[model samples]
Structures are given as C-alpha cells and as structure tokens.
Target: MHETDVAIIGAGPVGLFAVFECGMLKMRCTVIDALDAIGGQCTALYPEKPIYDIPAHPAIAGGDLIAALDRQIAPFAPRLLLGQRVERMTDLGDGWIVIATSAGETVRAKAVIIAAGAGAFGPNRPPLPGIEAFEATSGVRYFVNKREDFRGKSVVIAGGGDSAVDWALSLKDIAAKVMFVHRRPKFRAAPETVAQLEAAAERGEVEMVVPYQLHGLAGDDGVLRAVEVATLKGEIRTLPADHLLAFFGLSMELGPIAEWGLGLTHNHVTVTPATCETNIPGVFAIGDIATYPGKLKLILQGFSEAAMAAHAIHPRVFPGEALHFEYSTSKGVKTA
Candidate 1:
C-alpha cells in the first residue's frame, strides 16, 4: 500500500503534466499506468510520428515529447505504478480515496485524477483472413513507427482517412511504389492534403485505385508478395506489394473503468469544465477521457485541464489551508 495527495490514472503526456502541476502546488502524486512505460498512446502507437500542434515546438516526435515531459517532472519524483490497470476506486467519505489495481496493490490518496486517453486504445484492424498471421510477422503494419524501414519497399496502403492519405504522401518519395486502395473515390483528409495526393498520382508517384476493397493477400509464410483488390461489381486485380498498411482509425474502450459509476458521455468521463471534476467528489477526469460541452480534444487543452484539476484538488489535500495562487517564478519547484 502507498499513500499520496493525489493518485493519477494514466501516465500519458497529460498525466505526466498533472504531476508537475500538482507538484508545483506542493501536492505529491502517485502515477499509475497499464503500460510498462510512460507516454501511453504516443509511445505505444506512433513514437516516431511528428506532432505539429504541441506549443513551443515547431515539430517533435511523440517519444521525444514524452522524454521532455519526464524531465520536466523529474524534481517531483512522483511514485510510478506501471504495468497495472486501475481496477477499482473507493471514495473514503472523508475527502479521501482508496484505489485498487490489477496487480493487487492499493493506493490511498486525498484525490484522484483520471487522464486515461480514450481509455485502452488500439488501431482498428481490417477484417481480413489470415491477417493475424501477417501481423505477427511484420508483413502488415497498422502503425508507422519508423518510416525508414519502408524505404525501397512496395507498400499497399488501404483506407480513405487522414492516416492512409498522409502515410501515402509520407512514403511516396521513399517507397519503391505506393499503391492506394479505397472503397470510395473521396478521401476524408484535409482538402490540401488530398490535393497533394492527387498531384502525386498525376506525377506517377502514387497509383490511385478507387472503389475497391481488399479481397485477398498473396504471400508465403506470412510474408506479403501481392495484394488483391476487387470492385463492387466483382472485377478483381492483383497489385505487387511487399507490405500492407491499414489505417482503419482506432477503437477505444473504457475497460474496467466503465464500472466506476462516473457520469459517462460516449465513453468519456463527464466533468465540470471549471475544475475538471467528475460527478464523484474527490475524483476528477482530464485529457481525452474527459468531455464537456464545446471541448476541444487537444493536448494543450489537457494541460489546462491538469492545472485546473490540481488547483481544485489542493484544498482537499490541505484542509483549511488557504491556497494563494502564485506563478512558478515566485515559488520554484522544491525537489525531493
């Protein structure tokens, strides 16, 4: 068993930032995550993908961004409970909470903050026969971890969303051949990006095969050699390919957190915008797993949510202590 001022669920960017915000307010935190390491989806999904929206950074890879966040919160030295999923949370009526983990560990804290990003998330795999076999052999990859690995290779990208369109453009110059297959002629990407894809197709850089669906894959021992596609009318065609990249978006589930009884709106925890507090007292939700009216799902917004939640939790951790709001310059971080 461990005790702290706050027990934060999810060790993603927002969760890590919460440690700093709470630390700056003189609150100690215990961070819990299901993954063995921090960074959550960024580390698990696309670590090498460059994120352009992070403030003060023109461009930063997902892994590097998490590394910077880890450094920023180093002085706090928050306890990290990794490789365990939060199974249950019990609010101790007296403004305190007890948390239970899948690893059979317990955590008692004054408050709880949930930063679970879309809960447990993963790329939605397409319904294809023997797809799992190829998936295990790297013949089919849903994530683009390292772009250099696809260089000088033939890739068959399927889907009409931003990922399929973006990756096609990203690997067009690197891959020996880029074959894009989609069931619809229209792409669900930014218009400018779609225009760029069209231009690339015109220049013979990308081959656009529209109104088709993946029919079968030809390979030996889980190694891809060609991709077969068929039109709605049953016209089939085989395209040479070394790999298949399927961008079917991601599927999100609340997992065991669903039974926590917090107000849920479309798998997201309902929170008051002012303090990021959920219906349960001493329990708050932040980041993508939290939702309110007119909420913009962005990391910057999550950072703001973290600050609000920390400030709201400050009073609970230190009862009867007045919180005089002050900037970091006034009271620098006190290291452990």
Candidate 2:
C-alpha cells in the first residue's frame, strides 16, 4: 500500500501541473496513468502536432510541451505509476480514501483528482474493407509516431482534419510521394495550415485528391499497392500508394468513471468552476474530463483548474493548517 496527500488519476499535462500546484502547498502526490508513458494524448496521439494556443510560446509541438511539463514538476518528486488505471476508490472514513489500480497497487490519499482526459482512447479506424489487414501488415497507420518510417515511400493521407493536413505537410519533404485525399474541397484544418497545404498542392510537391472519399484498398498479401477513392459524384479512380495514412480522430471512452456515480453532463464529469471539485467530496475533476458553465477545454484553462483544486484540497490534506498562497517567483520552488 502507498500513501500520499493526493492521488491523481492521470499523468497528462494537466495532472503533471497539478503536482506542481499541490507541491507548492507542501503536499505530496502520486499520479497514475493508463498509458505506458506520461503526457497522455499529447504524447500518445499527436506528439509531432503543433499547438498554437499555449501561452508564451508562439507554437510548440505536442511532445515538447509534455517534456516541458515534466521538467516543471521535477521539483515535486511526485510518484508516477504509468500503464495503470485506478479501478476503484473506497472511502476509508475519517478523511482517508483508498484507490486501487488495475495493476494491483493500492494507494491511500487524503484527496483524489480525476484528471483522466477523455478516459481511455483509441484511433477511429476508417471504414475501408481490409483496413484491419493493412493495419496488421503496417501498410496503414492512423497516427505518425515517426516520420522517418515513410521516407522515400509513396504515402496517401485521408482526412480533412488538422492531423491529416499537418502530417501531409510534415512528411512532404521526406516521403518520395505524398498525396492528400479529402471528401470536401475546403479542409477543416487551421487557415494557415490549409493555405500551406493548398500551396503545396499547387506546387506539385503534394498531390491533392479533393472531393473524394476512400472507397477501397488494393493490395497483395496485406501490402498496399494502390488506394481506390470515389468522388462524391460517384466517379472512382485509383491512386498509387505504398502506405495509407488515415487521420480519422479518436474515440473516447469514460470507462469506470461513468459508473462511479459522479454527476455527468454529456460524458464529462460535472464540476464547480470555482474549485474544480466534482459532486463527490474529495474527488475533483479537471482538464477535458471536467465540465462546467462557460468551460473551455484548453490546457491553460486546465492549469488554472489544477491550482484551484489543489487549494481546495489543501485544507483537507493538512487539517488545521491554513494555506498561505504565494507566487512561484515570490517563493521559488524548493526541490524535495
């Protein structure tokens, strides 16, 4: 059994920042994540993807942001258990809570924070036949973990979302041939990205198969040789491709949290904006997993929520102690 002042049920960026906030109040934290590594979706889903809205930085890659967060919380020395999910939470009474993980680890904490953003997630696979076969043979990939894998190979990307456009641009110079096929004429990606993609299409560096949808796959023994696509008007054609990159987004599952009796609105746990505390006492929710009035699912917003939850939980962790909040610049972090 492990013991801590707070048990955080996610090791994503928001959860990592929570450790910093709680540590500022001199509280210990143990963070648990279902992924084998920390950073959650940022690391798992789109590490190479660029984020523009994070404060200070004009633009930062997803993986870099996670690394920065990791360094920021290093002073806290918080315990991190990766590839584990908190399966059950029991009230031990007298302000103590027991959190049991799927990995057979038990943690006792004074408070709990449910920062599991979108819970467990998996790629939204496209509906093309034999897609799973291609997946098994490495001919089709949903997310790009490494751009070098497609070097000097013909690659066809399907989708109009940011992931599709971003990967197309990222892999254009590396891949021998890069083609982007989308169902609509106008891409759903950011304006600048769309402009870049359009310019690339015009320059002949990347082929644009617009107003077309993935219709079929042509391959031998699961090795894709070409991709069959159909226009919305029913015209069909085949595009030569060694690999198919489909960025159809992700399917989120709330998993056990939905059965935990917490008040939920459209799958997001309902929380008070003031403290990010959920309907359940001592169980707070933050980040994208939390829902409240006028809520914005931004990382900066989640950082603020983490601070709020930590302050709200301070009194419970140190019963009679009053928290004297101070800025990091005023009272610099002291490494434990």
Candidate 3:
C-alpha cells in the first residue's frame, strides 16, 4: 500500500495537469491508469493526431502534448500506478480514502479525483464474418498505429467518421491504391477533410464508394484478398485489397467507477464547478468525466477545473492550513 495526498483516477492530460496543481500546494499525488503507460486515451488512441485548442500552442500532436505534460510535472515527481484499473474506493472517515486497483495494489489518500475521459474505450469493429481472424493476423486494423504498414498496398477503409476520413487522406500518398466505402453520401469528418477527400477522389487517387456497408471480408488466416460491400439496393461488390481499415469510432464504458455511488448525469460525474467536488466529500471529478451547467468538454476547460479541484482539495488534506495560492512564475516549482 502507498500513501499520498491525492489519488487521481486517470493519467490523461487533465489528470497530469492536476498533479502540477496539487504539487504547487505541496500535496503529493499518485496517478492511476488502466493503460500500461500514461496519457490515457490521448496516448492510446490517436497519438499522432493534431490538437488545435491547447493553450499557448496553436497546434500540437497528441503524443507531443503528453510528453510536454510529463515534463511539466517532472519536478513534482508524482507516483504513477499504471496498467491497473481502480477496482474499489472506500472512505476511511476523518477525510482519508483508500483506493484499490485491479492489480491488488492499494493507496491511501486524503482525496480522490476522477479525471477519466470517456472511461475505458475500444474501437467499434465492423460486423463482418471472419473479421476477428483478420484482426488477430494484422490483415485488418481498426486504427493506424503505423502508417508505413500500408505503404505500397491496396487498402480499403470503412466508415464515414473523422478517423475514416483522416486516415484516408493521410494514407492516400503512401498506399498504392486507396478506396473509401461508406453507408452515406455525406461524411462526418471536418469540412476541410471532406474537401480534401473529394479532391483526392477527383484526382483519381482514391475510389469513393458511397451508400455501401461492409458485407463480408475475404481472407485466409492472415492474408486479406478483398473487401466485400453491399449496396442499399442489395448489390454486392468486391474491392481487391491487401488491408482493410475500419474506423467505426469507439465504444466507451464507465466501468467500475460507475459503482462508486457518485452523482451521475449521462454517465458523467456531476460536480460543483466552483469546487470541482462531487456529491462525495473529498472526492472530486474533473475533465470530460466531470459535468456541470454550461460545461464545455475541452482540454482548456479541464485545466481550469483541475486548478479548482486542487485548491478545494488542499484544505481537506491539511486541515486548518492556510492556502496562499501563488503563480508558478512568482514562486517557481520547489524541488524536494
């Protein structure tokens, strides 16, 4: 078992930032994440994707942001408990809370903060026969972990979401032949990306097959021969391909956190925006997992919530202690 001032439930951008905030108030923190590494979904899902709304940076890659956050909190030296999902949390009266993880590790802290964004997420796979066979063999990929894998190969992409459009445009120059098949004429990606896909289609670099859904997949143990699609009119067509990429988005679950008996609204924890605290005293919620009136699910907003939660949590950890909040520039990070 370990002990800290705060036990953050997620190690994403918001949770990482909270470590910095808590550190400023001389509070030790332990960040727990189900993933083997930090950065949560940002690192696990789209590490190469670009984010435009982070403060001070016009645009930054997802992985870069996580790296920067890791650096910013390095001085704090918060303990990281990764690869373990929080299994249970118990209030130990007198303002102490004990949290246990799936790995059987336990941590006692004065406060708990839930910064899990969309909770545990997994890609929504397409409903096709033998899809799992290809999935296990790398013939079918739900995400573009490495763009070079599709180099000089015939690729068929399914879905009409941002991931589908983005990957289509991203791999257009690398793949020998790229085809995008969707069930609707319109795409759910950004307008600019949709325009780029259209321009690529017009240039004959990409084949656009609309009003079609994935019917089946033709492949062997680990080899993909082609992708079969069915039109709305019941017409079936096959596209020869070496790889099939499906971007049907993700499925999110709150998991064990939902059983904690916190006030929940639409699967999100309800918190008072002022304190960023939930119905359970000494337990706070921030980032996308926290919802209040006029809440905007943005990274910057979560940063502000993290600050508020840290300030509110300070009093609980050290009873009757005066909190004189100072800017980082005023009193730079203090190293132990």
Candidate 4:
C-alpha cells in the first residue's frame, strides 16, 4: 500500500499538468496510467499529428506538445505508476481507498483523480459481416500502434473522424495504396487537415471513397484479400485490400468508478465549473472525464481545470497557506 495526497489516474496532458500543479501547492502526488508510457492518448493515438490550437505555437505535433509539457513539470519529480488501471474505489472513513490493478498486482492510494480520457473508451469497430473473421485471422487492425507494419500494403481506412483522416495522411507516403472510406461526404477533421488530405487524393497518393460503409471483408487462407463497400448511390463495389483499418470512433466506459454514487450526466462525472470538484468531497474529476456547464473538452480546458483542482486541494492538504504562486521560466540571452 502506498499513500499520497493526490493520485491522478491518467498520465495524459491533463493528468501530467495536474501532477505539476499539485506539486506547486506543496502536496505529494502520484500518477498512475494504464499505458506503459506517459502522455496518455496524445502519445498513444496520434503523436505524429499536428495540433494547431494550443495557443502559443502556430503548429505543434501532438507528441512534441506532450514532451514539452513533460519537460515543463520535470522539476516536480512526481511519482509515476505506469501500466496500472484503477479496479475499484472505496470510500473509507477518513479518505478514499483506490485499488489499481496492473500485471496481477494491486496498489492502493488515498485520493484518486479520474483523468482517463478517450482511453477509457474502447475502439469502435464497424458492424460489417466477416469483419470479425478477418480480425480473428490477424488481417484486420483496429488501432494502429506501428505504422511500419502497413508499409507497401493496400490499406482501407473507415471513418470520417480526425483519427481516420490523420492516419490516412500519415500513411500516404508509406503505404503503396491508401484508401479512405467515410460514410459522410464531409470530414470532421480540422479544415487544414482536410485540405491536405484532399490534395493527397488529387495527387493520386490516396483515394477517397465518400458516402460509403464497409459491407463485408473477404479473405483467403485466413488473410484478408478485399473489402465490399456500399456507396450512397445504391452501388456496391469490391476493392482489393491487404489490410482493413477501422477508426470509426470510440465508445467510452466510465469504469467501476461510475457506480460510486457520484453525480453524473450522460455517463460523465459532473464537477464544479470553477474548482473541478465533484459532488463527493475530496474527489475531483479532470480532463475529458469531467463535464460542467459551459465546459469544452479540450486539453487547454483540462489544464485550467487541473489548476483549479490544485487550488481547491491546497486547503485540505496544507493547513492555512496562501495559494498564490507563479511558474518561473529560465531566462536566456536573446540575440536578434
């Protein structure tokens, strides 16, 4: 059993920032994440994708932004528990008891913050017949962890979301034949990303299959060979494909913590808009896991929520200290 003033549940951008904010308030902190490394979904899902709305830089890769955030908070030296998932949480007399499961080991912590972003939500698979058979045969991939495996292979991606488009663009150069199949005519990705993808399509680097849904997967000898698609104009076509990648989206699971009598709306924990405090005392939710009035689900918004949560925890963790603090950056001589 380990004890800490705060135990953040996810090591994503929000959770990492929370660790630093808690440290600034002179509170001991420990962060646990289900992934082996930090940076959560940003690192796990779309690290190579560019993020343009982070306020400071005009454009930064998701992986680079995560690394910069990690560097900014390195001085805190927060304890990190990777590859762990919170199995259960029980409210004890004084504080809450969190049981995290990782590789057959159960670790306990005092206070817990559920920062599991879309990670808690498993991948959404297209409901196409024979798709399961192909997946079982290792011919279908749901989440792409390594891009090199698909090199020189004819790949078909399904989905109109950011993940699907970003991956289509990322693999355009590596994949011999890349095709993006979306049920909708318009994409949901950033306009700039959409423009880039359109250019790739125009240059014959990628093919766009609009207003189409995967109908079935065909394979021979337990390996995928092609896919059957139904287009919007009542036309069905079969395309040769070596691999099928489904990035339709994800469905979130609140996990066991949802049954802890916490107030929730639409399966998301409700928190105070300003403080990020939940209905339960000593329990706070941050990042995409939390919802409040006028709350927008963005990494920048999560950072602000974490700072507010830290301010609220200061009184409970540290007796009567003033909560005013500032982050100091090292000065460098500039020659312009």
User: For every model in order, what is the number of clashing pairs?
Assistant: 0, 0, 0, 0
Using lDDT as the measure, name the better of candidate 2 and candidate 3: 2
Clashing pairs in 4: none
Q: In candidate 4, what are the lDDT values of residues 132-231, reduced to their tens digit?
A: 7788866787666677888899999988877788889889899999989988879888788899999999999999987788988888766999988997
Supply candidate 3's per-residue lDDT for 330.
Answer: 98
- Residue-wise lDDT of candidate 3 within 1-336, one digit each (tens)? 988999999999999999999988999999999999999777887786667679889767778999999999999999999999999999988778999999999999999999999788898987787788888878898876567888999999998977788888878899999999999889888788899899999999899988899998897776889999999889999999999988888888999999999999988999998999999999999999999999997899999999999999998888898987788899897544
| Winner by TM-score between candidate 3 and candidate 1 | 1
lDDT of 3: 0.90
**Order the candidates by lDDT, highest first — what do you get?**
1, 2, 3, 4
Looking at model 1, the pairs that clash are none
List ranges where model 4 is wrong by over 4 Å. 55-66, 92-111, 136-138, 232-234, 330-336
Question: What lDDT score belongs to each candidate, Candidate 1 first?
Answer: 0.92, 0.90, 0.90, 0.79
Total clashes for model 4: 0
Model 3: how far residue 261 lies from native, Å: 0.6
Model 1 lDDT, full chain set? 0.92
Off by over 4 Å in 1: 329-336
lDDT of 4: 0.79
Question: Candidate 3: lDDT of 72?
Answer: 90
Better of 3 and 4 by TM-score: 3
Task: Summarize candidate 2's per-residue lDDT along 253-322 as a digit string, tens digits.
Answer: 8988888889999889999999998888999999999999999878999999999999999999988987
